[model samples]
Target: MFISVVIPTYNRKPILEKCLKALEKQEFNDDIIRNYEVVLVDDGSTDGTLEWLEKNKEKFTHVSCFSQNHLGPAAARNLGVTKANGDIIIFIDSDLVVTETFLQCHADALIKGEKKLGSDRLFTYGAVINTCNFDDPTSEPYKITDFSAAYFATGNVAIARKWLEKAGLFDTRFQLYGWEDLELGVRLKQLDLKLIKCPEAVGYHWHPPFNLGQIPNLIDKEIQRGRMGVLFYEKHPTFEVRLMIQMTLLHRILWGILSLGGILNERTLAPILQWLINQGKPQLALEIARIFLNWYNVQGVYSAYRDMVKN
Candidate 1:
C-alpha cells in the first residue's frame, strides 16, 4: 500500500517546511505502507520555494516536487493526482504539520475499514487541530474551534486513487477560496463512498495569530469563498448545496441578525478587535470578527448568484 501524500502549496514556505519534516519522520509498517512519497505541488510561488526545495532535496528524500502557474489549489491538486505513482492518495494542506504516527494511523484505519466493509469503498478523514503557535504547532491541544464536520476536506484526508478518478476529481471552476473540496465530496458521496473517521491521525494546522492587520485579507478570503460557493451551487444545484453555501434565507437572516445588516463590519469592529488583540485574545477577536465575516460571505454569495442568474 504505497501512499502518495498530495500537498498543494502557495506561498506557505515556512509552515511547509514543518509539514515536510513531519512527513519525513512518519513511522509506518513497511508491510502496511510499503513506501510513501510526498507529492508537493507548488502553485507558482514567487517566494523562492522552488529554489529552497531544490537546494534541500537531500533532506526531503521522500518528496517529489512539481510546479505550475498560480492556478490555485484545485488545479495544483489535479496535477499532483495526475503525477502521483501511488494507488493510495492522501491529501493534506501544506500548512498542516502532523505526528510521526500520522501515516501509520491512517493506514491502520484503512486496513480496518476495508476489512469491515469488505471493500475499499472509503476514505479516511484525519483530525485537524488549528493552532496559532507557529513555533510549535504540533504541541497545541485541540479546541472546540478546531472541530470540523466536513466529510472530505483536504486539510487531512486519504483516499484510494480510483475513487477520486471515479468521482471525476475536483472542479477547477471553483478557482476561488473555498468549496472545491466539499464540492468534490458531494460527487464522491453520490458514488457511495464512505468517510472513515481516523481521529488518531491528527494534523496541527498552523497559521499566524489573527490581528487587526489581517482583517482585510480575511474579508477578501470570505468574499472569494462566497464567489466559489456560487460556483459550487451551479454544479450541484441541490438543497444540500444551497445550505452548504449558506445561500438560503436561513443563512441570510442569521448573518443579517448577527451582523445587524452589515453595520457590524470590519470598520465598526476594528476598535474592539484591536483591543482584543492587545489584550492577548486574538482567537476571541477572530471569533467575534466572524460575525461580520460570515455576513460578508452571505452577501457575497448572494451577489454572485444574482450575477450568475442575470447572465
Candidate 2:
C-alpha cells in the first residue's frame, strides 16, 4: 500500500533537510519510494525555506512542496492531507529522525488488521524514541477508554485516509499548539475507528535544548491554556470532573504565588495560576480564594489586576 509522509514545517530548514534525508534511507526500496510521496507543507516560513526546497527538490523524486499563510501546524497539516496522493498518511514532525522501517511498519499493520467498516484499515499510533531520554520505557501503552481525548505520542502517528476523512481534520480552532491531537483522537474513537499503539515503529526525536524564546507570550499562552480547559469542559461536562480541574488550577495558582514570594520554586505554578485567572470562572475564583486563606487569593487578584494594567 502506498503511504504519503506529510511533514509540516515552519522556518526550520536545516532540521527539515535532515528529516528528508532520513526518509531517503528507509528500508522500503525504490518501488515503495516511487509509490509514496513526501508532502512538505511549509507554513509561511520566512527563513529562506523556499530557496532550500528549490535547491533540494531534485534530490528526492517524489518530493512535493506546498506553501500557505502562517496558520500554524494544524492548518498546514490539513492542507497537506488535501494534496496527498497515498492511501495512508504518516505524520512525522520535521524535528524527528525516522527509522528505515517507520513507514513500512504502519503500512504493514493496516495490511494485517481485520476488516472494518468503510475502510479495511485501522488507525495506528506510535511512540517517538525521545532523544531527551526522559520518558519511562517501562510504561506500557494503555488503551484510551475515556472522553478525555487522551492520545499517545504525537511525534509519530499514522492514519488511513478514510479514517481521517471520517474523523474529520484537526480542529483549526486550536490555532497554533496543544490539545488538537487529543481532541481529534477523541473524535476518532467516537467514530468507532480502532486506535492501536504500535510500540515498535520508532523514530528518534532530537528535542532541542530549552530556550526561553520558544515560550509563548506569558499571558497569551495562559489564555490559550484556559481556552483549551474551557473547551474540554464544554465537551465533557461533569460536576466532579470540572471540580477536579478547577482544584488543579487552584493548586498551581497557590504554588505560583508562594514561589514568587521565595517560599517555593515550582516553575510551572505561575503559568497555571495565570491560566485559572484568565478562565474568569466565578466558581473557580471563589474556590481559589477559599483554599489559600484569602491572602494568596488576594495576591492572585492583584497579579491579574497588574496584568491588565500592563496590557
Listed per model in order, the count of residue pairs whose N, CA or C atoms clash below 3 Å is 0, 0
TM value for model 2: 0.68
Measured with C-alpha atoms, the lDDT of residue 88 in candidate 2 is 81
TM-score of every candidate relative to the true structure:
0.99, 0.68
Best by TM-score: 1
**How much lDDT does each candidate structure score?**
0.94, 0.62
RMSD of each: 0.8, 9.9
The model with the greatest lDDT is: 1
